[model samples]
Target: MFVLSVLLLIAAVVLFLVGRGKERSASGWKLGAALSAVAGLLAGLFACVHVVSAYEVGVPVAFGKVGSPLTSGVHFKSPFTDVTSFSTRPVDLNLNDDDVVEVRSSQGGVLYADVTIKWAVVPAKAVGLYRLAGSEEAVEERLVLPDSREIIRNVFAKHTSEEGYASAREQIGSEIADLVKERLAPRGIDVTFVNLRNVRPSKKLQEQIDKKIQQEQATERATEASRTATAEAERKRIEAEGVARANKIIERSLSDKVLYNQCLEAYKEAAKAHPVYAVPCGTDSNGTPVIVDGSKSG
Candidate 1:
């Protein structure tokens, strides 16, 4: 606008000087001044017409041919040309995952799921994406989100409820992220996060899963009890065998002659301490008795 105004002002001054030098009428000068003023006004209006914005770069085209995109500062272009503003900043897209749909599992169970994915267009490739995919909505509708849903369903379908909740959740999340990146990276959208927020199975399936878990736990308990009983029985059997072996050793160490000799020795020791009692020799109740007929010994 400034350049065009200056050009018009110079033209008016030139016209005035020439008309005055030739002694032309003042009306000619007025006419020339009016034309210059109008030209300047129109030029200024044309220059100020297009948009110059922040966080935006204009893709300028001249006569239907692709021109250089305007950088992050002030830019001026022809009034008749087209300039498309492309945002250079990151865009945050929140895609709600409620699709109002139910999918059946292989086990005759119906699974209902609500999940969200965070994604955005890579700002650098926005123009190329627009050219190829037409619009961000089009890109999402055609390419990015469908792939996301497919990846999510594929990952989720492989897991049981327990697996989906506990061990396989991280695996599913990682797989979804990988799958989305694989599909979206080529289309210039970066998938930052893919999360499985909520997954619900049919009520009947949930009950079945619960009952199955309960039965498994009961089986485990029964096996544990049987192991304990078997161990106790083995311990008692070992103890009984030990006692029987000890009794056999005691029996082997005893004899009738040894018992008789032990008794005789004890009786003799007692009789020597008490001599007044005449314990008969041959038919004595005591096994050892004092010998009163020692003089008749032949």
Candidate 2:
């Protein structure tokens, strides 16, 4: 740890105190003085040596003054400084974990969702970031969390509960990423991707939407049934009219002579089958005889 150098310095001070309280010529006094010198030297050397990992950059601070960012690998610095580490790689700030945010929609319906924002330290502006926020975690607390939460809430508020869970979900995430990027970019943080996932509306609102959908479906079924019944009734009416028209045509064409001829033909067919005779039963309007079966005449 970087603080190991500070501990060494304190030990050196302790050794120096022990030597001061002893007799100048004493062996114990000489031993304390030598140990004090060795401790001080070691402290200085350890403080100057900083080991930064591949994913991290170190910012050196000395006597309340901040210096330039030190990139990965071993760096030599002054003995009076402290180093703060920040990652150059992408960092995930998960709003779904401990940072869950609950938002109210435009229609005052409650919504909950999972959100993730990916960001990274801008290398060129690391010194400025270190000056503004003491550490990476401090940057999140002071900058990332507050801005992101507010942006998300504001964006979601522009949509209704139904839109929040469905239509406007993707748009909300995109607005968050853009706005957060605008705010953090000036302060050395690069916002990458924003993910919106698992958006859920409150139970009451969901039930309302479900009920409305069901009612619409029922109405559609009723309308289709009505149309089917009307079409069937019209088809039957049209068929009845056609049959009546055909019967009227046959009535208009028939005459008394045709009827008398039809009866005579029927009588002759009966006589051939049995010993039945044909007789004149009546006269038509044209003075034609109406044939009848003689055996059945009473």
Candidate 3:
């Protein structure tokens, strides 16, 4: 504005100096004066127009009223109109991973959680977000950051330390994602990811947890050992029973008379292979191979 005013003053001075005497010719002086004012006004108007950037979208407003949104590139509007440019690209928010959230477990113990989430503004919802939140700072302040934290806290509180730490990790993240999506969907934002970075128990509780796990593992090992020992004892008992039953069957099949008959047959078969001389002493007494009265025996 200052530069334009200076140029206009100079133009006026030059016109005054050259057309001072020509003022007597009213028509000529008026024409010169009119031309000078026209040039100054044009210069001033050019100075008032600030260039709308190509990397941004401008929201033009007349007086205090906002008009239609403008796409990036070059555009012309009234010099006095207000233009507010907004970003259409994605904006990333990085949250800390060590933030602790307090939650009461099913056992009434307090659980601490540390989590991190990476997210961005959805492109299509940028306009609606701008309308509600006014700016990027407002978006985080009013919607994204607060709601994300709320979802995390809500989901964390429902599960115990062990459940939240390992067992229900996927479940918790899914719940958080769902909650965020539902909350922000109306406002034109999408919850891209909800990550559970870490979960820690209290120091005192940690010691107890470690001890419990160890005890459980030891008990399982002992049970397995007992099962193996019992299996071995049962196998041995079955083998012993089988051997005893077989022995009883064999004993029942053998007899003293059978043994005596087998021995007589063996002796008869042996006598046929050798020459023998015998003299019988007594005929009244029953004698079978009695060698005491025999004179010679084979």
In terms of TM-score, which candidate is strongest? 2
lDDT leaderboard ranking:
2, 1, 3
C-alpha local distance difference test of each model: 0.68, 0.81, 0.68
Instruction: Write the candidate numbers in order of decreasing TM-score.
Output: 2, 3, 1
Determine which window of 10 residues in candidate 2 has minimal summed lDDT.
288-297
Clashing pairs for predicted structure model 2, backbone only: none
lDDT of model 2 at position 144: 83
> What lDDT does model 3 reach?
0.68
Model 1 error, position 81 (Å): 5.7
- Model 1 regions more than 4 Å off: 1-71, 77-115, 158-161, 197-202, 257-298
Better of 2 and 3 by TM-score: 2
TM-score of each: 0.61, 0.74, 0.61
Q: 1-298 in candidate 2: lDDT tens per residue? A: 3456566556667666766776674567656656755766676687689998998888888998888888899998877788899998998888885567888899898888788888888877888888888788988888888888898899889888878989877788788778889988999999888888668876887788899899999999999999999999999999999999999998988787787778778777877987666674357466555444556648
Local error of candidate 3 at residue 121 (angstroms): 4.3
Tens-digit lDDT track of model 3 for 132-248: 777767877788778877877777778777887679888887887788878887886655666666666777777878999999999999999999999999999999999999999
Model 1 steric clash pairs? none
Best by lDDT: 2
Error of 2 at 293 (Å): 9.2
